[model samples]
Target: MTNDSPKPDDDAVRARVIEAADRLYYAYGVQAIGMDTLRTEAGVSLKRLYRLFPSKESILEQVLLHRHDMWNGLVERAIEGGEPRERLLAIYDMLARWFDEDDFRGCVFINCFGELGTTTPRVAEIVRTHKAGFQARLAELVAEAGGPQSLAPQLAILAEGAQTTAAIAGTNDAARQARQAAEVLIDAALGPATGTAQTRTSTTVTTARPAFRSRR
Candidate 1:
Protein backbone atom coordinates (compact mmCIF):
# COMPACT_ATOMS: atom_id res chain seq x y z
CA MET A 1 0.00 0.00 0.00
CA THR A 2 2.35 2.69 -1.31
CA ASN A 3 0.44 5.87 -1.97
CA ASP A 4 2.65 8.34 -3.79
CA SER A 5 2.14 11.87 -2.46
CA PRO A 6 4.84 14.52 -2.08
CA LYS A 7 5.28 15.31 1.57
CA PRO A 8 6.08 18.91 2.46
CA ASP A 9 9.44 19.63 4.05
CA ASP A 10 8.86 20.52 7.67
CA ASP A 11 11.60 23.14 7.76
CA ALA A 12 10.40 24.88 4.63
CA VAL A 13 6.79 24.78 5.72
CA ARG A 14 7.60 26.13 9.17
CA ALA A 15 9.59 29.02 7.73
CA ARG A 16 6.74 29.94 5.39
CA VAL A 17 4.23 29.81 8.20
CA ILE A 18 6.40 32.01 10.40
CA GLU A 19 7.02 34.47 7.57
CA ALA A 20 3.33 34.80 6.79
CA ALA A 21 2.44 34.99 10.45
CA ASP A 22 4.95 37.77 11.09
CA ARG A 23 3.60 39.92 8.26
CA LEU A 24 -0.05 39.33 9.04
CA TYR A 25 0.27 39.48 12.81
CA TYR A 26 2.22 42.71 12.67
CA ALA A 27 -0.12 44.27 10.11
CA TYR A 28 -3.36 43.12 11.71
CA GLY A 29 -3.77 42.31 15.36
CA VAL A 30 -3.13 38.62 16.07
CA GLN A 31 -6.78 37.84 16.94
CA ALA A 32 -8.06 39.30 13.70
CA ILE A 33 -6.21 36.84 11.48
CA GLY A 34 -7.72 33.40 10.94
CA MET A 35 -6.16 30.04 10.15
CA ASP A 36 -7.55 30.09 6.61
CA THR A 37 -5.89 33.40 5.89
CA LEU A 38 -2.62 32.13 7.29
CA ARG A 39 -2.79 28.93 5.25
CA THR A 40 -3.57 30.85 2.09
CA GLU A 41 -0.93 33.48 2.73
CA ALA A 42 1.63 30.85 3.58
CA GLY A 43 0.57 28.73 0.56
CA VAL A 44 0.65 25.56 2.58
CA SER A 45 -2.04 22.91 2.80
CA LEU A 46 -4.23 22.88 5.91
CA LYS A 47 -2.85 19.55 7.01
CA ARG A 48 0.69 20.71 6.52
CA LEU A 49 0.09 23.92 8.41
CA TYR A 50 -1.50 22.02 11.24
CA ARG A 51 1.39 19.60 11.34
CA LEU A 52 3.80 22.53 11.59
CA PHE A 53 1.74 24.50 14.12
CA PRO A 54 -1.24 22.87 15.77
CA SER A 55 -3.10 26.10 16.48
CA LYS A 56 -3.13 29.85 16.05
CA GLU A 57 -1.84 30.23 19.59
CA SER A 58 1.19 28.13 18.71
CA ILE A 59 1.82 30.11 15.56
CA LEU A 60 1.53 33.43 17.40
CA GLU A 61 3.97 32.32 20.05
CA GLN A 62 6.49 31.19 17.47
CA VAL A 63 6.08 34.44 15.54
CA LEU A 64 6.73 36.53 18.65
CA LEU A 65 9.76 34.49 19.56
CA HIS A 66 11.10 34.73 16.02
CA ARG A 67 10.72 38.49 16.08
CA HIS A 68 12.46 38.67 19.43
CA ASP A 69 15.50 36.93 17.96
CA MET A 70 15.54 39.19 14.91
CA TRP A 71 15.05 42.43 16.85
CA ASN A 72 17.69 41.55 19.42
CA GLY A 73 20.12 40.42 16.73
CA LEU A 74 19.81 43.78 14.98
CA VAL A 75 20.47 45.67 18.21
CA GLU A 76 23.45 43.47 19.00
CA ARG A 77 24.91 44.05 15.54
CA ALA A 78 24.40 47.78 15.85
CA ILE A 79 26.28 47.85 19.11
CA GLU A 80 28.76 45.16 18.21
CA GLY A 81 31.95 47.18 18.55
CA GLY A 82 33.16 50.70 19.35
CA GLU A 83 33.39 52.97 22.28
CA PRO A 84 31.06 51.87 25.05
CA ARG A 85 29.66 55.39 25.20
CA GLU A 86 29.17 55.47 21.45
CA ARG A 87 27.57 52.06 21.62
CA LEU A 88 25.01 53.53 24.00
CA LEU A 89 24.19 56.27 21.50
CA ALA A 90 24.08 53.67 18.73
CA ILE A 91 21.05 52.10 20.37
CA TYR A 92 19.02 55.17 19.47
CA ASP A 93 20.75 55.43 16.13
CA MET A 94 19.54 51.94 15.32
CA LEU A 95 16.02 52.90 16.38
CA ALA A 96 16.06 55.86 14.00
CA ARG A 97 16.71 53.48 11.11
CA TRP A 98 13.99 51.11 12.27
CA PHE A 99 11.50 53.96 12.59
CA ASP A 100 12.16 54.91 8.96
CA GLU A 101 11.11 51.45 7.72
CA ASP A 102 7.92 51.61 5.65
CA ASP A 103 6.31 48.90 7.73
CA PHE A 104 7.36 50.45 11.01
CA ARG A 105 5.00 49.79 13.88
CA GLY A 106 5.70 50.39 17.52
CA CYS A 107 7.61 47.77 19.48
CA VAL A 108 6.21 44.30 18.71
CA PHE A 109 6.10 43.23 22.36
CA ILE A 110 4.39 46.47 23.32
CA ASN A 111 1.77 45.95 20.62
CA CYS A 112 1.25 42.31 21.59
CA PHE A 113 0.96 43.18 25.27
CA GLY A 114 -1.75 45.72 24.47
CA GLU A 115 -3.71 43.27 22.35
CA LEU A 116 -3.34 39.93 24.21
CA GLY A 117 -1.61 40.39 27.55
CA THR A 118 -4.86 40.56 29.51
CA THR A 119 -6.39 37.48 27.90
CA THR A 120 -3.31 35.34 27.25
CA PRO A 121 -0.87 34.60 29.99
CA ARG A 122 1.63 33.17 27.51
CA VAL A 123 1.60 36.39 25.49
CA ALA A 124 2.18 38.43 28.65
CA GLU A 125 5.11 36.24 29.60
CA ILE A 126 6.66 36.57 26.16
CA VAL A 127 6.40 40.35 26.31
CA ARG A 128 7.90 40.44 29.80
CA THR A 129 10.80 38.22 28.72
CA HIS A 130 11.52 40.40 25.69
CA LYS A 131 11.47 43.58 27.80
CA ALA A 132 13.71 42.03 30.42
CA GLY A 133 16.15 40.86 27.78
CA PHE A 134 16.19 44.33 26.25
CA GLN A 135 16.93 45.96 29.61
CA ALA A 136 19.61 43.38 30.31
CA ARG A 137 21.41 44.28 27.11
CA LEU A 138 21.23 47.93 28.10
CA ALA A 139 22.62 47.09 31.46
CA GLU A 140 25.54 45.33 29.85
CA LEU A 141 26.32 48.36 27.70
CA VAL A 142 25.98 50.74 30.65
CA ALA A 143 28.29 48.66 32.79
CA GLU A 144 30.88 48.53 30.01
CA ALA A 145 30.65 52.30 29.61
CA GLY A 146 31.71 52.71 33.27
CA GLY A 147 28.21 53.70 34.31
CA PRO A 148 26.31 52.07 37.11
CA GLN A 149 23.95 49.17 36.35
CA SER A 150 21.20 51.27 37.97
CA LEU A 151 21.23 53.58 34.92
CA ALA A 152 20.18 50.72 32.65
CA PRO A 153 16.50 50.91 33.62
CA GLN A 154 16.47 54.69 33.22
CA LEU A 155 18.04 54.40 29.77
CA ALA A 156 15.54 51.71 28.85
CA ILE A 157 12.73 54.13 29.73
CA LEU A 158 14.14 56.78 27.39
CA ALA A 159 14.52 54.23 24.63
CA GLU A 160 10.99 52.89 25.07
CA GLY A 161 9.54 56.41 25.25
CA ALA A 162 11.38 57.43 22.10
CA GLN A 163 10.16 54.32 20.28
CA THR A 164 6.55 54.95 21.31
CA THR A 165 6.69 58.64 20.47
CA ALA A 166 8.27 57.96 17.09
CA ALA A 167 5.58 55.48 16.20
CA ILE A 168 2.81 57.94 17.13
CA ALA A 169 4.42 61.11 15.75
CA GLY A 170 5.81 59.43 12.59
CA THR A 171 9.25 60.97 13.11
CA ASN A 172 12.70 59.63 14.02
CA ASP A 173 13.73 62.74 15.93
CA ALA A 174 12.47 61.10 19.07
CA ALA A 175 15.47 58.79 19.00
CA ARG A 176 17.78 61.72 18.67
CA GLN A 177 16.25 63.41 21.68
CA ALA A 178 16.56 60.20 23.60
CA ARG A 179 20.21 59.89 22.65
CA GLN A 180 20.89 63.43 23.87
CA ALA A 181 19.13 62.73 27.12
CA ALA A 182 21.12 59.52 27.47
CA GLU A 183 24.34 61.49 27.15
CA VAL A 184 23.41 63.53 30.21
CA LEU A 185 22.60 60.42 32.18
CA ILE A 186 25.78 58.66 31.16
CA ASP A 187 27.93 61.69 31.95
CA ALA A 188 26.26 62.08 35.31
CA ALA A 189 26.99 58.47 36.16
CA LEU A 190 30.39 58.01 34.50
CA GLY A 191 31.67 61.60 34.67
CA PRO A 192 33.93 63.21 32.04
CA ALA A 193 35.63 60.67 29.81
CA THR A 194 38.52 62.74 28.48
CA GLY A 195 39.58 64.20 31.83
CA THR A 196 40.10 62.91 35.34
CA ALA A 197 37.19 62.84 37.78
CA GLN A 198 39.08 65.35 39.96
CA THR A 199 38.92 67.86 37.09
CA ARG A 200 35.11 67.74 37.26
CA THR A 201 33.48 70.00 39.86
CA SER A 202 29.82 69.92 40.92
CA THR A 203 29.10 72.96 38.71
CA THR A 204 31.07 71.59 35.74
CA VAL A 205 29.93 67.97 35.86
CA THR A 206 27.19 68.33 33.31
CA THR A 207 28.29 68.70 29.73
CA ALA A 208 26.84 71.23 27.29
CA ARG A 209 23.76 69.90 25.56
CA PRO A 210 23.80 70.23 21.82
CA ALA A 211 20.96 70.41 19.28
CA PHE A 212 19.86 66.89 18.56
CA ARG A 213 20.13 65.59 14.98
CA SER A 214 19.52 62.23 13.33
CA ARG A 215 22.76 60.68 12.05
CA ARG A 216 21.53 57.53 10.35
Candidate 2:
Protein backbone atom coordinates (compact mmCIF):
# COMPACT_ATOMS: atom_id res chain seq x y z
CA MET A 1 0.00 0.00 0.00
CA THR A 2 1.32 3.46 -0.88
CA ASN A 3 1.10 6.40 1.51
CA ASP A 4 -1.10 9.11 0.02
CA SER A 5 -1.16 11.96 2.56
CA PRO A 6 -1.22 15.35 0.87
CA LYS A 7 1.55 17.68 1.94
CA PRO A 8 0.34 20.71 3.85
CA ASP A 9 1.22 24.04 2.24
CA ASP A 10 3.32 26.66 4.03
CA ASP A 11 0.34 28.84 4.92
CA ALA A 12 -1.61 25.95 6.36
CA VAL A 13 1.42 24.75 8.29
CA ARG A 14 2.17 28.24 9.58
CA ALA A 15 -1.39 28.71 10.77
CA ARG A 16 -1.43 25.32 12.42
CA VAL A 17 1.83 25.96 14.20
CA ILE A 18 0.76 29.40 15.42
CA GLU A 19 -2.63 28.12 16.54
CA ALA A 20 -1.07 25.29 18.49
CA ALA A 21 1.65 27.49 19.86
CA ASP A 22 -0.81 30.15 21.00
CA ARG A 23 -2.99 27.62 22.80
CA LEU A 24 -0.16 25.64 24.33
CA TYR A 25 2.17 28.51 25.12
CA TYR A 26 -0.56 30.60 26.72
CA ALA A 27 -1.89 27.71 28.80
CA TYR A 28 1.40 26.10 29.70
CA GLY A 29 4.20 28.73 29.85
CA VAL A 30 6.73 29.02 27.04
CA GLN A 31 9.46 27.08 28.83
CA ALA A 32 7.21 24.15 29.58
CA ILE A 33 6.03 23.42 26.04
CA GLY A 34 8.67 21.82 23.79
CA MET A 35 8.87 21.69 20.01
CA ASP A 36 8.02 17.99 19.90
CA THR A 37 4.77 18.64 21.71
CA LEU A 38 4.08 21.55 19.37
CA ARG A 39 4.69 19.27 16.40
CA THR A 40 2.21 16.73 17.70
CA GLU A 41 -0.39 19.34 18.53
CA ALA A 42 0.12 21.19 15.23
CA GLY A 43 0.05 17.90 13.25
CA VAL A 44 3.12 19.01 11.36
CA SER A 45 6.12 16.77 10.73
CA LEU A 46 9.33 17.66 12.56
CA LYS A 47 11.01 18.59 9.31
CA ARG A 48 8.10 20.82 8.36
CA LEU A 49 8.06 22.51 11.76
CA TYR A 50 11.78 23.24 11.49
CA ARG A 51 11.34 24.50 7.98
CA LEU A 52 8.60 26.87 9.16
CA PHE A 53 10.44 27.93 12.30
CA PRO A 54 14.17 27.47 12.52
CA SER A 55 14.04 26.99 16.28
CA LYS A 56 11.80 27.15 19.34
CA GLU A 57 12.80 30.74 20.07
CA SER A 58 11.73 31.79 16.60
CA ILE A 59 8.34 30.14 17.13
CA LEU A 60 8.00 31.85 20.50
CA GLU A 61 8.71 35.23 18.93
CA GLN A 62 6.09 34.57 16.26
CA VAL A 63 3.58 33.51 18.90
CA LEU A 64 4.13 36.72 20.88
CA LEU A 65 3.75 38.82 17.75
CA HIS A 66 0.55 36.93 16.87
CA ARG A 67 -0.76 37.58 20.37
CA HIS A 68 0.03 41.30 20.12
CA ASP A 69 -1.99 41.49 16.92
CA MET A 70 -4.88 39.55 18.45
CA TRP A 71 -4.96 41.70 21.60
CA ASN A 72 -4.88 44.94 19.64
CA GLY A 73 -7.72 43.74 17.41
CA LEU A 74 -9.84 42.82 20.41
CA VAL A 75 -9.42 46.24 22.00
CA GLU A 76 -9.95 48.13 18.74
CA ARG A 77 -13.16 46.26 17.94
CA ALA A 78 -14.53 46.84 21.40
CA ILE A 79 -13.90 50.58 21.19
CA GLU A 80 -14.57 51.24 17.51
CA GLY A 81 -18.29 51.94 17.96
CA GLY A 82 -17.96 54.18 20.98
CA GLU A 83 -17.39 57.90 21.50
CA PRO A 84 -13.94 59.15 22.49
CA ARG A 85 -14.59 58.87 26.22
CA GLU A 86 -16.44 55.65 25.66
CA ARG A 87 -13.43 54.33 23.84
CA LEU A 88 -11.28 54.69 26.95
CA LEU A 89 -13.88 53.04 29.18
CA ALA A 90 -14.36 50.34 26.58
CA ILE A 91 -10.89 49.09 27.36
CA TYR A 92 -11.79 48.36 30.98
CA ASP A 93 -15.10 46.83 29.95
CA MET A 94 -13.27 44.48 27.61
CA LEU A 95 -10.90 43.49 30.38
CA ALA A 96 -13.76 42.70 32.75
CA ARG A 97 -15.36 40.45 30.17
CA TRP A 98 -12.06 38.76 29.44
CA PHE A 99 -11.41 38.10 33.12
CA ASP A 100 -14.50 35.92 33.23
CA GLU A 101 -13.40 33.70 30.36
CA ASP A 102 -12.83 30.09 31.42
CA ASP A 103 -9.21 30.03 30.41
CA PHE A 104 -8.27 33.50 31.61
CA ARG A 105 -4.57 33.29 32.45
CA GLY A 106 -3.58 36.82 33.31
CA CYS A 107 -1.92 38.21 30.16
CA VAL A 108 0.09 36.06 27.80
CA PHE A 109 2.85 38.65 27.53
CA ILE A 110 2.87 39.35 31.28
CA ASN A 111 2.79 35.64 32.09
CA CYS A 112 5.51 34.84 29.60
CA PHE A 113 7.63 37.69 30.91
CA GLY A 114 7.29 36.48 34.46
CA GLU A 115 8.07 32.91 33.47
CA LEU A 116 10.82 33.29 30.86
CA GLY A 117 11.77 36.92 30.33
CA THR A 118 15.08 36.71 32.12
CA THR A 119 16.31 33.86 29.97
CA THR A 120 14.65 34.76 26.68
CA PRO A 121 15.84 37.93 25.03
CA ARG A 122 13.30 37.68 22.21
CA VAL A 123 10.47 37.16 24.69
CA ALA A 124 11.53 40.23 26.65
CA GLU A 125 11.71 42.35 23.52
CA ILE A 126 8.30 41.11 22.40
CA VAL A 127 6.80 41.89 25.81
CA ARG A 128 8.15 45.44 25.70
CA THR A 129 6.89 45.87 22.16
CA HIS A 130 3.44 44.62 23.10
CA LYS A 131 3.24 46.98 26.05
CA ALA A 132 4.52 49.95 24.06
CA GLY A 133 1.89 49.28 21.41
CA PHE A 134 -0.87 49.15 24.02
CA GLN A 135 0.30 52.41 25.57
CA ALA A 136 0.36 54.03 22.15
CA ARG A 137 -3.26 52.98 21.55
CA LEU A 138 -4.32 54.37 24.92
CA ALA A 139 -2.54 57.62 24.14
CA GLU A 140 -4.49 57.94 20.93
CA LEU A 141 -7.75 57.48 22.82
CA VAL A 142 -6.71 60.05 25.42
CA ALA A 143 -5.87 62.61 22.77
CA GLU A 144 -9.17 61.90 21.07
CA ALA A 145 -10.98 62.70 24.30
CA GLY A 146 -9.26 66.13 24.54
CA GLY A 147 -7.05 64.81 27.30
CA PRO A 148 -3.49 65.96 27.78
CA GLN A 149 -0.83 63.62 26.42
CA SER A 150 0.71 63.38 29.91
CA LEU A 151 -2.40 61.61 31.18
CA ALA A 152 -2.15 58.74 28.72
CA PRO A 153 0.75 57.02 30.44
CA GLN A 154 -0.96 57.30 33.79
CA LEU A 155 -4.14 55.74 32.43
CA ALA A 156 -2.17 52.95 30.82
CA ILE A 157 -0.54 52.20 34.16
CA LEU A 158 -3.91 51.94 35.82
CA ALA A 159 -5.07 49.55 33.12
CA GLU A 160 -2.02 47.34 33.54
CA GLY A 161 -2.34 47.39 37.31
CA ALA A 162 -5.99 46.42 37.06
CA GLN A 163 -5.14 43.39 34.97
CA THR A 164 -2.39 42.30 37.31
CA THR A 165 -4.58 42.71 40.37
CA ALA A 166 -7.56 40.99 38.80
CA ALA A 167 -5.46 38.06 37.67
CA ILE A 168 -3.71 37.66 41.00
CA ALA A 169 -6.77 38.10 43.20
CA GLY A 170 -9.11 36.19 40.90
CA THR A 171 -11.67 38.94 41.22
CA ASN A 172 -13.79 40.79 38.65
CA ASP A 173 -13.72 44.12 40.51
CA ALA A 174 -10.35 45.38 39.38
CA ALA A 175 -11.55 46.52 35.97
CA ARG A 176 -14.42 48.47 37.50
CA GLN A 177 -12.14 50.02 40.07
CA ALA A 178 -9.66 50.90 37.39
CA ARG A 179 -12.43 52.32 35.26
CA GLN A 180 -13.55 54.54 38.12
CA ALA A 181 -10.04 55.77 38.66
CA ALA A 182 -9.62 56.32 34.96
CA GLU A 183 -12.73 58.48 34.84
CA VAL A 184 -11.40 60.69 37.60
CA LEU A 185 -8.03 60.98 35.90
CA ILE A 186 -9.59 61.69 32.55
CA ASP A 187 -11.90 64.31 33.98
CA ALA A 188 -9.11 66.10 35.79
CA ALA A 189 -6.94 65.97 32.73
CA LEU A 190 -9.69 67.28 30.48
CA GLY A 191 -11.16 69.85 32.92
CA PRO A 192 -14.51 70.42 34.70
CA ALA A 193 -17.73 68.95 33.38
CA THR A 194 -19.71 71.20 31.03
CA GLY A 195 -22.81 71.03 33.22
CA THR A 196 -20.97 71.91 36.41
CA ALA A 197 -20.31 75.63 37.02
CA GLN A 198 -16.64 76.14 37.85
CA THR A 199 -13.76 78.45 37.12
CA ARG A 200 -11.33 76.99 34.61
CA THR A 201 -7.61 77.59 34.36
CA SER A 202 -6.70 79.35 31.12
CA THR A 203 -2.96 78.78 31.50
CA THR A 204 -1.40 75.43 30.65
CA VAL A 205 -0.75 73.23 33.70
CA THR A 206 2.18 70.88 33.82
CA THR A 207 1.97 67.56 35.60
CA ALA A 208 4.66 66.67 38.08
CA ARG A 209 6.48 63.38 37.79
CA PRO A 210 4.22 60.42 38.51
CA ALA A 211 4.37 59.28 42.11
CA PHE A 212 3.63 55.66 41.32
CA ARG A 213 6.58 53.35 41.84
CA SER A 214 7.97 51.42 38.94
CA ARG A 215 6.47 47.97 38.38
CA ARG A 216 9.47 46.92 36.37
Best by lDDT: 1
Total clashes, candidate 1? 0
- CA RMSD, predictions in order: 10.1, 8.6
Q: Clashing residue pairs, candidate 2?
A: none
lDDT of 2 by residue, 52-162 (tens): 777787777777777777787787777765456767788999999988888887888899889879987767777887787788778777766667899888988988998
Model 1: lowest-lDDT 10 consecutive positions: 200-209
Q: Runs in model 2 with CA error above 4 Å? A: 1-8, 192-216
1-216 per-residue lDDT for model 1 (tens digits): 222233546678788899999999888878899999999999988877776676787887888878877877788778766677777788999999999999988887888888999998888887887788788778777766667888999999999999889989998999999999988988899875663332211111111211222211
| lDDT (C-alpha, whole model) for all candidates | 0.78, 0.77
Q: In model 2, what lDDT does residue 50 have?
A: 82
What's the count of clashing pairs in each model shown? 0, 0
Q: Give the TM-score of candidate 1.
A: 0.84
